[model samples]
Target chain A: MQLQINNKTHEVDADGDTPLLWVIRDNLGMTGTKYGCGLAQCGACSVLVDGEIVRSCVTPLDSVIGRSVTTIEAIETDPVGKAVVAAWVNHQVPQCGYCQSGQVMAATALLKQTPNPTEDDIAAAMVNLCRCGTYNFIKTAVNEVAGRKEASL
Target chain B: MKKFLLTLIAIIVIAGGGLFWFVTHKPGSPFDGETASAAPADLVHRGEMVARQADCVACHSTPDSKPFSGGLEMGTPLGSIFATNISPDKQTGIGNYTLADFDRAVRHGVTPDGKRLYPAMPYPSYVKMTDDDIRALYAFMMNGVQPQNVPNKPSGIEWPMNMRWPLALWNAVFVPSGTYAAKPQQDEQWNRGAYLVQAAGHCGACHTPRSVTMNEKALDEGGTDFLAGALLDGWYAPSLRQDHNTGLARWSEDDIFAFLKNGRNKHAVVFGSMAEAYNNSTQFMTDDDLKAISHYLKSLPGDPARDGQPWAYVAATSATGNAGKPGAQTYAAKCGFCHGTDGRGKNEWIPPLAGAASSLISHSESQVNVTLNGSARVVTADIPDAYRMPSFREQLSDRQIADVISYVRSSWGNHGGPVTPEDVKALREHTDPASSNPIVLQMR
Candidate 1:
């Protein structure tokens, strides 16, 4: 089977039902994506599939055959992803960087789809879990990328 | 006046005696005069096969109990009753039961002491089992199975209701006599299929509707009611006939065979009680036998009037556009990952919610119960399923479950109507997820 990952088409040999996370981290040797809560409860394995956020741990390989997948390895290639990453660095959103890759993917997808998203849109799209309690920093970073000021708390 | 009184007294005496004799009369068995002989190894093996076909262990034993040691409590309208021990222990089990005694109990639903077994034994359907199968089953029960010393639990029904004699009268009206005779007109495969279904398989015990008297409306495909679907326990056992909406109108013979053999197919995966049936009984069947059963089930026609319009999938308006709807956003967040935003599941692994029997049928119990309790693990060939629906009773409230279920039922061309929080609440109280989890039997 062929997979389009980060602007390159890679030929992969694995069962179709195998999770996309396995193919990405193990098969392609791209370890940027993190695996957490394999049941899709936590979004640590989030990736951009055709510019939409999807939890790759639950995404079957067959479902992403003809689509483009952007992992944390190539997040800076896309313009929106670059802005999201820049905002993340400026706000210091990673106390522990394990969940930031998925968090960045989620913010990039949200901003790409809704350039000027509301707080509700941010809340709904940025649902990834960060165990280090980096939510306030992550929220401020996404709000900056969305060009909206965080309301006084 | 004196002559009338005398006649009335005589009539009362005779009627009372006749009723007593009817209830206490023990039915004679084919092996009535035969003694227990030493069964060969192959006969015991064959008997084991027959027991599998009959799925006796399903109700006969609890998860923690020894096989056939019977302590599963079955609920009845009147009260609860426990399944009796069928092991070969002389005091606690059927160890002392002679060939005649065993035959009488298995086929005739009568113990050697003239006590009538409850209809819950499914003796109505077992009556059609062939004499050869009965002999093999008896041989296996005596020789193959080890004796368990588990004592039988008594019924919870109070005095007047607990009396077993009334079941004798119930049996005479509802139960039939003798073994199945193959129809000459049907082909060999169909007859074999029919015999398995009507006799040993006893599919109608759940699939067929019961009357006011609590007897199955029909015993075989000769009546339209056979395998037409009915509610048992809490789940609605969907129609096995050709009904387009609530039945297997869309499923092919291969699909049915695959479902029974592999525990799933493109259309649906086994859940609810069907999961247990798959794990304990159907998966053990031979390939040819499964094919025959599938063929026989497919032959039963569905009623157009009862089935209503066939299901056709219609795409949900929009994933984000329908966010205003009660359950749309919740579904996208919770269900869309696996069940897809479009309700089409990924391949045969996760079952599709669109055009599903639970989504199409009016009864919302199965959908609600499954959502609240989740599904039992469908372990096929000793491998557990990769994906399972997790229980949401703690995470979601009753209204949330109702809304999400209603949303699924109302969407994708499904006609199952809206569900209320009350329905979800009722099932939550009545159901225990631990009980539904089938312990894979090791019947060595």
Candidate 2:
């Protein structure tokens, strides 16, 4: 299978049912994408499949065979992704950092699609689960990326 | 005879004066002459660091609640006791508390109004804090934290149990009132580690066994059972002692330090209640402090008889399982995919079942709890892991859960012993699924 990840093309041998998370982590060695809940309940494996946030753990390799997959590694290349990453750092959003790649990916996707998201839009779109309960900081980071003042805790 | 009498009188007078001085004199605080306004910024910053070391935020605040506006419910054998607001709110929090009141409450577990506090506040450990630390803590609480007027919640303990007077007597008997004394026999690093573990870090609050009165079975190194390990909140905090199997005997100092700093090492990953501590507290500690902790923990001896034999990995030939046994079949069908047919999990991400503490320890509560309800999300450095264990409660029957656990325990050189169906049922009834929202405290 051929996949476009981080603006680079790669040919890999994996089963059609193999989760993109494993292919990225084990086979391709792009371990930035975590394996949180193999069942898409947690968005720890969130990635951009043609600009839409998809839970890579549940998204099979075949589904994104020819699509552009943007991960945490390449999110910095785009202006929106760069802004989100900067906001994340400014807010000190990560605690354990295992779920951050997915979080960053999800946030970037939200900014790309909505550009100016309301609290309700953010609440609805940013569904990635954080065990550290960093949602408050995450909201602040998103607002910062959206060129708004940081929300008070 | 006259000369002898005069000499005796002089000796008596001198001895009496010395005794009086010893009894009356106490260490004066550096801030004794200064007012709260005169407290230096550096001192307040130090105090904030100390607060983090003490993990004041972990119990004092709830997720989405203002920091230090305590409302976290602590479960006790008696009942649930809510942590009181320690924020500087004038009406509802500790804003009115004088420094002396704060001292007494923190070190002696006595309120300003002479009410006794439960040991759940861990004043026994706090008693060992130096006067300087106490002064700084008071300064920080007064100045650094934002005042929240959140009213305190009353404990659910009934009648006589709720009566606080007995706690005064309990305090008198069990609580030691003084700062930590450095042991002459140990090095500076060792003593620092001791002070941090016994006082500020309050490792014993979870690790040490409690008496019927809920007093820690031992306070410090003087007691053999100190840090020997205990069961609390359905999880067993493994011994910090040097037991090869259940404790840090096999782990080097680096391993301990790594676990504290990074939350996971080659041995195991932090989960359950410890994940919270790692997320909020230990990960922020300096490398020197983490090393000191490791040094102190490693010095403790393990209980050989209690820990049993050290574990060694025994490889299984194939991914396929033994047929006919329902327990083996259950393991193969349900657990084998992720855990592997051999029972050894993949790397640090998926913890290996072979020689895993949850599977090998005598305490079966954690095993049962995780198996039934699955794990709470492990978020370190704000990054949630991509993988988590899904809840098996709905999918597996109590008997099946018991069988699978028993099979795991007996197999792969794991010797945690058998768990009965009744045990699973009891845990099933009491425990709830791990909430995706872990207790995250935003300590300023």
Candidate 3:
């Protein structure tokens, strides 16, 4: 499989049916993309496929061979990623580090597409499972980054 | 060969002796499931009281979910670990657990057969629970709960890290089993609140910051940071102290009671973990207990240095051209429907964002997150209102959110810190909308 991860191209030897999560984790040694639920239920395995946030746990490696696969690692390359990362630290949004990268990836995607997202927008997008249940802080960071996105524009 | 044999024999002798000493000298476990030959006549009654005091059902159970069936996934720094099956079903749950097993899990941070439990179990706080409460909790969990056939989900923690034996050492360092003692001068209410919050409820599990060792910073009121709001699980369990921003500065005892009882009042509604606390613990609490919590919370003094300047709204032009100012326009277009133009909502229904303790926090972190994701659905009392704040993920942009939120904060004399778009983006990536479908695990 030839894959573009965080803008870098890599060739990997893996089964086509293997979840993108395994390719990123076991094959490419990209530990940053976590394995949450292999099922698409939790957004912990979320990554950007051609700038669209997609749950990688369900996305097959075969499907995303050519598309840009953006994980949390590459989020800062985009201005939206930078803003979102800043907001997360400022808000201290991570409880356990496991789910954060996915959360960040989804947030950057949201900001890039929509400069400003409303509370409702936040709800639909940030639906990752946070067992610590820090939904309140997530909203604060998203709103702040949205403002910053506007300021930059 | 002689040295090896001597060492082996010595090892066996030492190991056997250690095992004997361990059984004899182990600190009495609070949740041990060792059942006495004769059952206490009021074991079930005591268990009910203990369950209420600890608010055990809040995290272990879900709204419309199973009671103590343990399917709830608790997110930790490691990974999302599902709460274990506490119900007594030998095939699937803790049916075979003895009283000693329950005590170790609850207070000693050990499972049956001495399996160490993760700190996520809140044993650090639970260790403060009284012996009687532990016994009661054991009785309640073992008997009151409907035995579930649900199998326990393995934790997401990777291999060597998932091992539980190390937790025994962790407990040795942190867990201290002692009931809360009342201060000589403080009244009954304060003591009651202290006991409930510190021991049974384990509010500090979320409210207090953790150390490098993951132990809660301070166990009691000795440390000023006890319940003094540290960011956790994404949301800051805003200071329980009476601070201008992010504390109980503006809430009267009655207001606190209202919020706790019904999940929403005039000021704010509980969401996130607090929402669960309300659904499982606070709402069911007796009126006096709520008042005790209020009294305890109000006594905590705020730190002006940490809180920063009180929020004063001087409306600026909205960043978005869609409305008068982006902030005001967003508020007018979106928020006004529920919060109203004045920032006040219907009593005990939609919460007014004005003068909310959370809105006043020096950091706009919690404020930004909640507005973006909307609130956990509140269905309390006989009134099950379907009017939830819709997810605008498809609608507004982040800047639009900031402007509107800034307007609300400033407009209502709320001195909450100004929000930044960077903050919005970070949380967007960091968080997901709370599931509207409550993880209700029905155990029977």
Candidate 4:
């Protein structure tokens, strides 16, 4: 299988049914995308497939054969991704940062679709789970990128 | 005159005998020589308070599991031992236990059936609880808790190692069966901190190093190792002692209070096992109690020779053409954006990597764990944080991660030393990403 990741195409031979998480982590050794629960319940393995946030742990490798896969490594290159990462750092939002890659991806995706996201939009879009419970910072970072004055709960 | 002298002699004898009895005779139980009385409603309330002081729910309850249902598996040198259900269920929990049974179990580390419990239960410190407190604890466990039928899981310890008899002997040597007596020299706040740290908080359980026999090296401030920190469950619980880099030497009393209250301060945020402690126990502490804890912790002196010179931040000039260096490019590409080329973080939120404890500590476990698995969430007051360090495990090779870490450690006057790829690989194999559902206990 040939997959485009971070704007680079790679040829990989793995089972079609193999989850993209394993393909990225075990086969390609791109571990920034974590395997939190393996179940889609946690968004730790979130990655952008043609700019849509998908739980890669459940998304099979075959699903991304033709689609462009953008991960945490590449997310920074995108304007929205860079802003989200910057906002995250400025806000000091991470603790035990296992779920952060997915968080950044989700936040980046949210910002791209809705440049001026309200607290409610953020609440609905940025649903990735963080064990460190960094949601307040997430909201703040989102608000900062959106150029809002008010804080989100 | 003779009659008067004889009466006086009889009175003196009776009084002397009474004094002797009072001094020598040990009270067997709270109920001894008193008629059986029902525990008052207020006593049950007090019992609940006592249980909270002990922080029983932290270990006894699993995340999203029933309170005190006791399924949390604790790792030991022998094997893993699951916490038992103490929720007063007759079939599986401690519902069938009498007050005497509770006392023996809590203080003596013995079960109703004469079986010895593993020392992991913290009964060594609990033995210091007063009889009244124990009675109240019994009342709380019996009356306050909702009984659950969750069956206790048997330990995974192998046969000879799993045998309970040795623990009795171990207890005899290590456990002190007496209530805490306040030191006359210390102030009330210090005494309170001492009581809470030594008994209820069980700070030594994780922070204090263990003996070859798996016993806590020290139980009180008298021992240098107490609260000096030990590695547990893949993360190093840095010393609560006064050690400059690794301990609380640099933390002010206010810093300590703030960390306890808010779960994060300028220096560091609570993560790993401590996140659970903050979520369930420390955040809810009274302000006075938090102050007292800080006061007590600050009294501990640091080892100048071991802790080395106090860390001073040194400014770093950006070196051009450093991309040729093994880790320099990785740092520039990966870390420098957040940490900066100077290695000083942007603000209080983005902790400075230069002289940061995570990079400066002798143990690289924390760094490796965070770099590999990423941190758990840092929730304060039920609000999740927004910023998070993404895991670099997949993006960077073990060698790359090690190289970058080494660069961070050696640079900006950080003296923590270099970490090897082998070290990174070992930690990566053992550790998992921080769970989103940290053990947040909701104790009533």
Best by lDDT: 1
lDDT by residue (tens digit), candidate 3, A1-153 = 798999899998975545678888888787888887554555788888888877776565766777899888778898888988988898888888788998898888888888878876777567777888877778788988877332211
TM-score to native of every candidate shown: 0.92, 0.71, 0.65, 0.67
What interface RMSD does every candidate have? 1.6, 10.8, 16.8, 16.1
- Whole-model Cα lDDT of every candidate shown, in order: 0.87, 0.82, 0.72, 0.79
Error of 3 at A67 (Å): 59
Poorest stretch of ten by lDDT in candidate 3 chain B:
B313-322
Candidate 3: which docking quality band?
Answer: incorrect
Candidate 2, residues B1-444, lDDT tens digits: the string is: 999999999999999887555433332333334444566898888888788888899989988699999998988778999999999999999998777778878887777777778888989999999988888888888888999999999899999879877676677689886889999999999999999999989999989988987889998988978988899988888888888778888789998998898777667777777877887888777889899999999999888898898788766544534444457766754565456667765445555677877777889988888888887666667766545666889988989999999988877778889999999999999888877665457776
Candidates in descending DockQ order: 1, 2, 4, 3
Residue B285, candidate 1: alpha-carbon lDDT: 88
Per-residue C-alpha lDDT of model 4 across residues B369-400, encoded as one tens digit per residue: 77777666666677654334567777789999
Residue-by-residue lDDT tens digits, candidate 3, B321-354: 3244447656654565355556655454556677
Candidate 2 TM-score, true structure as reference: 0.71
Ranking of candidates on TM-score, top first? 1, 2, 4, 3
lDDT, candidate 4, equals 0.79
Model 4, A46-95: lDDT tens digits are: 89888877777756576578899999988989999999999889888899
Candidate 2: C-alpha lDDT: 0.82
Quote the B-chain TM-score, candidate 3: 0.84
Tens-place lDDT per residue, model 1, B1-444, is 999999999999999999999999988888888877899999999999889889988888877888899988999988999999999999999999998898888887899899999888988999999989999998888888889998899899898998999988999899988888888988988988999999889899999999999999999888999998999999999999999989988999999999999888888888888888888889988999999999988999999899878889987665534567798767877787778878988777778999999898888998988888778778888977666676778878999999999899888888899999999999999897634344576555
The native-contact fraction of candidate 3 is: 0.00
Which number leads on DockQ? Answer: 1
True lDDT of residue B233, candidate 2: 86
Q: What is the lDDT of candidate 1?
A: 0.87
